[model samples]
Target: MNKAMICFLLLLSSPVIAQKQKTVDSKINHVTVFLSRAQIEREVRTQVEAGKTDLIITGLTSQLDQQSIQVAGKGNFIILGITHQQNYLSELNTPRSLRILKDSVEFFQKQLLIEQSQKEILNKEEQMLLSNQKIGGTNQNLTVAELKGMADFYRTRLGEIVIARMKHDDKIKKINERLTKVQQQIQTQNELYTRNTSEIVVSISADAPATVQLDVNYIVANAGWQPLYDLRALNTKAPVQLNYKANVYQSTGEEWKNVKLKLSTANPNQGGLKPELYAWYLDFDQPIYRGLQGKASGVRIKSAAPAMAMDKEEDAMEPPAETTADFVSTVQTSLNTVFDIALPYTVSSSNKPTLVDIRKQELKSDYLYSVAPKLDADAFLMARIVGWEELSLLPGEANVFFEGTFVTKTFIDPNNIKDTLSISLGRDKRIVVKREKLKDFSSRKAIGSKQSDSYAYAISVRNAKTEAIKIIVEDQVPVSQNTQIEVTATELNNANYTQETGKLIWEMTVQPNETRKVVYKFDVKYPKGKIIPAL
Candidate 1:
């Protein structure tokens, strides 16, 4: 036979193996959660028959981004295609531990229902007997012996019913208590107990029987994280300790038990295209609204970045007894930042925030006492932190601690364009401050068609603490918007005055047990016929 004829015969003789279908569970190995979304990585290991196989991986979040599904594997096989779909039948796709908790909850709940029903039946029997208690019936008369026997029977029956009801009630109470405990366990586990989840179907071509390990990863919309911070200061002399952390949450049905957790600052959902300036036209302002200021808005995106991965890797540093910040390593990129946690963490899919330690550092700060006695009677301790540009800090609320006591909560805004980050510690009662209008300088007079008002104020801050402290005093005067209204500073008292804003600031260091005073005087004049705004 010719060569072409021989090839055709050989191809016809070869076997055409059809693809076999199978379902396998995946283990969540790593998760890199962004500010609004998280990328979940799972590994699947299973045995495949010769030829072709279609593996369906169950128990993934149904809210995952379909376009972000990625599958790669290491085996003697070639992956053909990957597809995602909702799995209505995979309600039991949760891990064994979570499944046990759910089962226990169901068991206790059923038991509670049974006990309650028994109690209800006893109540019904007792109510019926009491309502029909007319000896035998309304029309029938009973003998003395019959009456006595009937009374005894009624009493005995009623007593039995009451006892049975109490027993049932006791059982119900215990069952309800057990059920509550089980439900709490479920909540703490954070396992999503919803019916609808997701599954990935992968088609692969294999030549022989072998084991295939597939690494599947996808981005889920239901999981994300936000930044949190703890700023503690022992005293003004030492540096401020900034403890960086994150609040991670997810509702994905799969529990991330002891998985490698990576907190990233890279926002995959961030707009890729740079923003363009729109056209601006300044015409006569139309009457749209009054006293409504225009606000500039921008998008805030949290991002995620990744580092090297391994089965067993030593932490950068051993975690302290209270904090795990030392075990976290920081990774920086041009666009965002990332913190790789070496320790394994179990984060249930309960959608509640699970605190994760990022890192901690000592930040230098300039401390001072601040008081605007006109607005507040107490002095607040302020810390001005500089050189925080390298920290890759996110805008978040911070808990302030002073002298081992929680003072108050403040915010850390990385978007602030200033050179320093200012933090306010709680009010200090030791520094007594008082503001009063000086009656000697306060007066109002009218001259011709104009009115003039002179106002003077005295702010005093007395330090009762044993150590000397520095403080700033502030007061402001009203600025005139109309030409007919004029404002003038009469007595500056060596204070730093901003003419545009009509603000007076006095900064001084007061010795222990000394009282420092700040005095400023201002005058406002306007047309007497035309009423002016408040001064």
Candidate 2:
């Protein structure tokens, strides 16, 4: 043999030459999950065949995004680059990312429904390891005897291998520890982030099918008034009843269901006069809660009519002789006239009631009366005049009277009179009038002046009423850098003022409608050319 032929023969004879190491190029197959109808359909079909009742498309896409593939009849999901042991440990240890990993694992286990023996083997091994930990023994102390017992209990061939691999892999151990810490940090950070981000956004697709929008129609009904006669006086009392109905419908022209309804009454005088009457009482007894609509009812009882004498008492007592001068004077004053009449009944609703006085008052049975009541009928009543029409006393409506020598007075029913004639006449005549005069006087002043560095303003308020009253003073100023507004009211010892960007508020309770004043001063500074208006 020649030298070249000998070399070739030697190479062929060598084990290294005959059985050479093959270079295998490892490539990570990147999974790209394309959101399409076909993939979803396939997954749905597969899940249906496997007996899953609830299938979430988003969950399936999430599994694919994490590079996991689910195969039927497999005990666990297959992660291309991860070994079975590595996957298990990763699932046990990873933080927030564990949800995806766990779902993937569960998906595989359910699909495959691995043999009972294999599952029991894994469970036995896990229990043995847990028992060892309880006894404070390391994984290395898991002897062959323990392993054999676990294997025998579960009757699985892979029990020993699983235990050995779990104990000896440093990467797996470190991965678990790192995963646990990372998960804790992530959980804490996620909770903080969610707390900080405190709002949820829901997106509705513009391309989705269109539907009709819901509409609401509200109508006020049963708005009428009835007379509430005064039992003591021959005057008509009118009580008004108002009803409202709200009809709700879907944009598809269908009626709505289980809609909540509410009624709110606003008194226009709440912010101006008669704040005590600004209360709104809800009438829930007349609620229409079923079907696609609801209705509500409210009633306001007007003044009642005064009481009247039954039968012809005058005919029984013998009619007084007809006097020409006396009868003419009574008829002349019978027409509607503004009389400074003192109320006979007590005002129960409020602490302060209208007080007026009239001396030597007379009334007759056939005379007419035009009396103006000052209590707020309604805050939003737009009518310039609101009261019941004049009517003769009858069985339903009666009028009241204070009989004096040479005078016969008729009183309207339902009027909130403070006292009867005896009590009204006995009391000091000037007390009620003085109290009303003090209650009516209220004044406030605002001072606006320009400054070199900024604009400033001062507010002064006075309450001249005898009774204590609360006054709210608000000042609005230009918002600028280093703006300072100070409100001063020495009389308002308990008052406090709050400052916002361009507004200041001061609340004070003046004594007995007494003249309590407040002054507010504020300063604003900006560029010279920029002139901020004083608000």
Candidate 3:
């Protein structure tokens, strides 16, 4: 019994064998970029000997989400578990481009140091000469010719020293400028120059010597894409050309070199609208000695379509869109959209915008000049786009170009339910518009218990272009909210008037070098004691 116990104790105290560890390098093969984050997928292949092998995948960015790490492999091995940690002793490997930038910064810094050192030496020499300027050490036995020769020597040397000092200072200034530029380049690139090291360790068990291929993916932060557009109109009669684009960027340290990219509109960082509720047991407040008994009831909400705040822009989900001709294939799912880019792209680790062309479309539009003379004398050219919603576009700022000239910027809002999208193409100074009050028709009178005020205005629009143009002129009258106040339009000049809004609209076509004028009058009557501010 004593020998058996001794053998068991020795067996329990023995050290367990450690697993063989191996460092594996992975290549980024695919990336799916969202509106605020990105998912990176990599392919790792390595050989594993028989037994438990620990594979450490290195070179990931510090902005990676540890909870999103997932690994799957194909071989005669079973994945036991996975863990993530930082290798504090070492950092990420420097890429060639960033190393070049660092070398440039170092070179400039060295040159600056040399120039500054030269300047300092020259200053010290000048100071030393100036402090020792007691000719012949205060002795009167020195000859005048010797003194004069010494003076000449001192003057020439001092002048040369000044010139040399100025030259050195100038060189230092130039070197400093170069140094600042290179440093800014490094900061602006914002690539894999971080000092933190990230590693994902995977524990696996294998039967025999086998080669394993790993499919590893994880979600990373500080990577996203935004919508950008360019709207161009070559002529008033031609269709508007819409160029949809995206500015994709990522600051995740690993560079995606020649990888497949798919843009997604879904943001994983945001919580979903659907929430689950479990059954709850309700009981009255009481101290009971018996077993607790209650009825269970709960509201089992659906997986989607929960109650949300009535923010039209955020809540109006996009319907299906007709896929058109483009290099990207749009796949619409229930919650979000996926745009598969056809070509392999090389998006650097630098957080700089890389312009990606989404698609180009020619949209049908109607152009009309809009003049609000009462507000401003400028007649704006407006374009009513017909079918912009079918493109599955987001609300983004657009650069407007009219007649091959760059105009002002406009925003395309997809939230509105209007069938046509209205965008201002800019003002047409060639079409002059003017509005003036008619003093002859303006008067104020009081009769009985009411006071009446009459006002009139005249507006003129001149078409100076070579072709005819259609314009919509707008004006308004006073709107009365009180029962004692009465507002009437005396003359509308054949304009369409809406009584509810007191708006007057005139649609007309003006030929080249033609002028059109309209005069309208209105009267407002209110109680004698009440004041009408709008009048």
Candidate 4:
């Protein structure tokens, strides 16, 4: 074929191109929430022709982080470009609720028009009565009967006009009142509409005729989930039931309906950078010289070493036949733990918190009574659990319950080196504890040029409960840092004593209504004329 003929033939054989822009709407299907942020995932499906086409997804949250937006597809279409734009078009100014209010205002406005017309008619009728005020013409005399009849006619007509005018006035008043209320409602609606920013406009294109499913994901601020726990200890011998939950809250202007929710412990707001330590050194200052005029003169000295930079810092379920159970799936990563809720949930854009059950576990705990006698005479009931790290627990506030009663509130921190989680289940009132100073054994005496001081304390623990209890009493002795002073724990009532921290711990089993006494004596030998603190 010739060149022109070949071009015509190629054009005839080419496929027809149909390029059209289509706006697609998406719904939130999944959300993975962090400590103070969340990842929102929305999906939409549509069909496209065998040419380049634009797919615009609208109605997204305005609190979306533009840099965190990600677009993915599962079809033959390829996303050419994606962008976010906020449009304040007049049509968007009226939300659904406000539209209803406007419709009401229009109805009231029509009533107002009728009321105004009625009022104008009343005014015109009154004016006409005033214009006809002449009772008799200036031409001739009238009979008495005729004059009396004219007066009666004027009285009746004037009375009817006044009554009709009053009714019109009342109707106008009511219409004005209705109008005022609608206006106020509109104002309040407008005030609430300030958060309505334009929707997200995504630019997508397709290559061939196919069904494309696009998934849009973005991070939203002002949304978060916090871990909460209810720790219930029925009895000392029974296992503790730990009901784990999350308080999810958000005000990101997007309501997640029937969406899969996942709570995470990852904090994206805190940047992942370990602060470095810089060497800090001090240099000797050179002596300054005084000037002849009695003025001080000093040379600006620079440090020999570089200056150190200051671093800135669930649910319960019922059993049924052939039932399908739903529970939150716990996933742990290197940095965070996730609780994926299997059931769908609806989370509104209000600041109110929605509590969701994550998981519940019956944990075996060792119950013990602990008392810091030097600080308080009350003994606290404590529970220690091992293998809690596998539970994927986070640091949060926990509510303690014992024997079907509210005990206290405590904090649960999972980051521990001992690998055992310890919780204080409030004070044990049945256990009485007291610490007394033994004055006879504690005295100071002078030996040559040195003073020898002996101090002793006795801790008593009495268990008044029906069952026997194990109590740990903790006290501390003075530890000296100077060579001139000598301190020693002369007598430790069969208790474990640590010389480094001068901590004395007494572990004893006290029978019911039995008192156990622990006595510890410490002697301090220091040079004369020296003061000993906390003696």
What C-alpha lDDT do the candidate models reach, one value each? 0.83, 0.27, 0.83, 0.77
To one decimal, what is the Cα RMSD in angstroms of model 4 from the true structure? 13.3
TM-score of 2: 0.17
The regions of model 1 sitting more than 4 angstroms off are 1-16, 47-50, 95-158, 166-191, 207-211, 275-322, 443-449, 529-533
TM-score of 3: 0.79
TM-score of each: 0.79, 0.17, 0.79, 0.70
Q: Which lDDT tens digits does candidate 1 get at residues 222-268?
A: 78888999999988888889999899998776678899888888776
lDDT of 2 at 58: 19
Clash pairs, model 1 backbone = 190-349, 190-350, 264-303, 264-304, 265-303, 265-304, 266-303, 266-304, 267-303
**Model 2 segments more than 4 A misplaced:** 1-451, 454-456, 464-466, 481-500, 533-535
lDDT tens digits, residues 232-337, model 3? Answer: 9987889998988888998777778888778877777664545454456556895444443434322111112222221112336784343222456666667777
**Which residue pairs of candidate 3 clash?**
none
lDDT of 4 by residue, 257-304 (tens): 799878887776764555545445555785444323322322111112
Writing each residue's lDDT as its tens digit, candidate 2 over 306-337 gives 23222222466767543111111111122221
Q: Weakest 10 consecutive residues, lDDT, candidate 3? A: 299-308
